[model samples]
Target chain A: MSIRDTLKDIVDNVEGALAAMIMAYDGIPIDEITVPQSGFDLQSLSVEYATVLKEIKRAAELVKAGAMEEVSITTNQTRVALRVLNEDLFTVLIMTRDGNFGKGRYLLRLKGYDLARELA
Target chain B: MSIRDTLKDIVDNVEGALAAMIMAYDGIPIDEITVPQSGFDLQSLSVEYATVLKEIKRAAELVKAGAMEEVSITTNQTRVALRVLNEDLFTVLIMTRDGNFGKGRYLLRLKGYDLARELA
Candidate 1:
């Protein structure tokens, strides 16, 4: 299966998931899948979030905390998870506030590797 | 107890804990505690992280995701958790990569309210 397909599987299986995409640390999208009426601009959101994630990734290294593996952000209306696939790439899953958060994380972990392999 | 004492209690109770602090989104610390030989500058780390976190908080709002409640970052040698206390204040916990992350998170939830109440 392709990267896009894997992302689709992730969004389809997770309740309330609106979008999933592979993004670069520099705010570029590699591949993405979004359901209609996601109610937000996934690309722009990913870009904004990438900038912050880059800062965090650098901070973790500066502190000798080792390479960042994952980041989870929970807001009142959304829960987003980003899992590092490589030094320059990470997979992001955007879900509703009431989405199955645990399952989203699990899918990210399980399928992120497939995305990473395709990139490699 | 004072905010400092509360921070101290959190660090002392959690295994491998390095530091805990209450910081504003603008990078000013309200209160903090760090054990000897923490091996890193907690203030500088928090300051840098605060900047990134502020961006994230704003992005969440911009996307209408509602107010960000929590963020967790995991790396090779350390794990950092941030819990929002209010619009201006948030609590941070830093621990070793192998620290009792679960307990650390629980403590933050239980004691963060105390810090928030004291601020009010």
Candidate 2:
């Protein structure tokens, strides 16, 4: 399907997932989908995280670890799973802390490939 | 147990575990241990990652996501798992790409408390 459909599929399928978005390493969002009343600014979070992810990708390369494929962050109130779509793009999922994080992770990987292909 | 002993314990118990360390958000290493032939500079990696971790913790707070409890990055050659012991300090486990990452994550949480206690 389309990029938005893929993003929507990820958010809709995962329990407690508030939003999903495709973002560039340079802090630009290509597209996003959020549930109504989700009540969180996921785009801002993604932009802030992109800066850190860029550094992380560089660090991984500097150490010869090769390309960073995934990075997940867990907090007391939420869980974020980010999967690299390619060198310049990535997908992020935002879920509640008590959400089905494992399932969210699984969906990110499953749909991340779909989103990547659509982008390509 | 001594902090060094606990750090060493984490590295020893997990397959493909190359190094472990306790570090502050400010980038100072509290304690660390590494295998003799790890052939990787884990210290530099940790130091570089600390900056990103600090930013992540802040972003989580800014989003009202609460404290950032853990972060994991996977690359082609290595996996790095970090667990926050407290606001200022966190534990890091570095393993080869094929390492037992689940075990490393568990040990970081299990022994992270021990190290936190030692520090407290």
Candidate 3:
């Protein structure tokens, strides 16, 4: 399946998932998908999250904490999961506030590999 | 108990917990603690995380995602959980890779109020 198709499938199968995007570390979107009625600005969000991922990578390196594998942000309105696929790319998923974080994390980890392979 | 005492108690009680810190939104450490033998750098990590918290808050604001309540980063060697206490302060906890994230999250939430009150 194409990367975009896989991202669409993920959003379709994951309950409460609002959007998903494959972003570069430099704040650019490679591929993205969002539930049509969800009303999320995936473009702006992807850029903002890419900045986050870059800062996290720097912080991890400074602390000798090894590379950052994943990050999850929980807010009053939503949960965001980020998985680093490689040095230059990562994926971000946005879900409902009460969404299944464990399931979201699982799917991101599972699909990250496939995405990485396809990108390679 | 004093905030320092409470922080110490948390590390002492939570298994595999390496360190904890209370930091201002501007990347200042208000109070912090680390396990004697853990060899973790709470000072640097706290500052780095404060920057992260700041950025996440900004991103959430731009995206209109309401307020950011918590953020968790899982790496190869540790799990770091961050809870925003108020507009000016937040708490960060670092745990061993195998530590219980649920317990860590629970403790931060439980103590966040007390710390906020004391700071006020």
Candidate 4:
């Protein structure tokens, strides 16, 4: 399936209460199909959010001579952030409060691996 | 110069009061030289830290159809987290409380790009 199609599956499966957004690691919105909308600052966040990924990539270089996987940020603000690296790409999602935070993360990761390989 | 050497220069420059550490995004410590060593959990944290990077890589894929840059995370705990991607590497630094959070980050990025190229 195409990448968009895969993303659709993610958002659809999440259903209502779960807001699905594909952001540019920089926090720029890629494509998100949901209601109630997300009021996050994707444009600015996209750039700032990237800092976390950049550092993680650095760690990977040293250990294993370069073999790193995923990284995340958890705040008391009811938001859980995860960053997955695929080549030179970054995929980020901001799960709404009602979103199945744990399940959503698991699914996204599964799909992420597939997407990464597809791109490769 | 080896990546380690470059890092040593960074720690030395940062000097006293600034605690320097090179940790895997997973929170695992790579190597850190300082008088008062940091007492953070590297083993468990390493795996968790990687999550942030993974989600970011996902974001990059969706936007620009696959072009992404650095990602960062900032906590009010006097600790600023940065992720600089270098090809297949991940470099993460937990800057000391007194470290030039901004400058340390800048140098890391410049060095990150160079290191990425070197590894490649």
TM-score of each: 0.91, 0.93, 0.93, 0.43
- Tell me the tens digit of each residue's lDDT in model 3 across B65-101: 7799999999999999999988899998899989988
lDDT (0 to 1) per candidate: 0.88, 0.86, 0.89, 0.53
Tens digit of per-residue lDDT, candidate 4, span B1-120: 776676676656642223344555454555544435455445544555566566555544433223334444433233445454543446665554455655766676677766566546
Best-fitting candidate, measured by DockQ?
Answer: 3
Model 2 residue runs over 4 Å out of place are none
What lDDT does candidate 1 reach at residue B112? Answer: 83
Query: What local lDDT does model 4 show for residue B91?
Result: 64
What does chain B score (TM) in every candidate? 0.94, 0.94, 0.94, 0.69
Superior candidate under DockQ, 3 versus 4: 3
Q: What TM-score does chain A of each model score against the native chain A?
A: 0.96, 0.94, 0.96, 0.68
User: Compared with the true structure, what per-residue lDDT tens digits does model 2 show for residues B1-120?
Assistant: 999999888888999999998898888888889899888776677678898798787777776777789999998788999899987899989898999998999989988788889988
Comparison by lDDT, 1 against 2, better one: 1
Worst 10 contiguous positions by lDDT, candidate 2 chain A: A40-49
Q: Judging by DockQ, tell me the better candidate of 2 and 4.
A: 2
Cα lDDT tens digits, model 3, A1-120, are 899998997888788999889999888899889888888888788889999888888998898887799999998999999999998899989999987778888989998889999998
Report how closely model 3 matches the true complex, as a DockQ value. Answer: 0.85
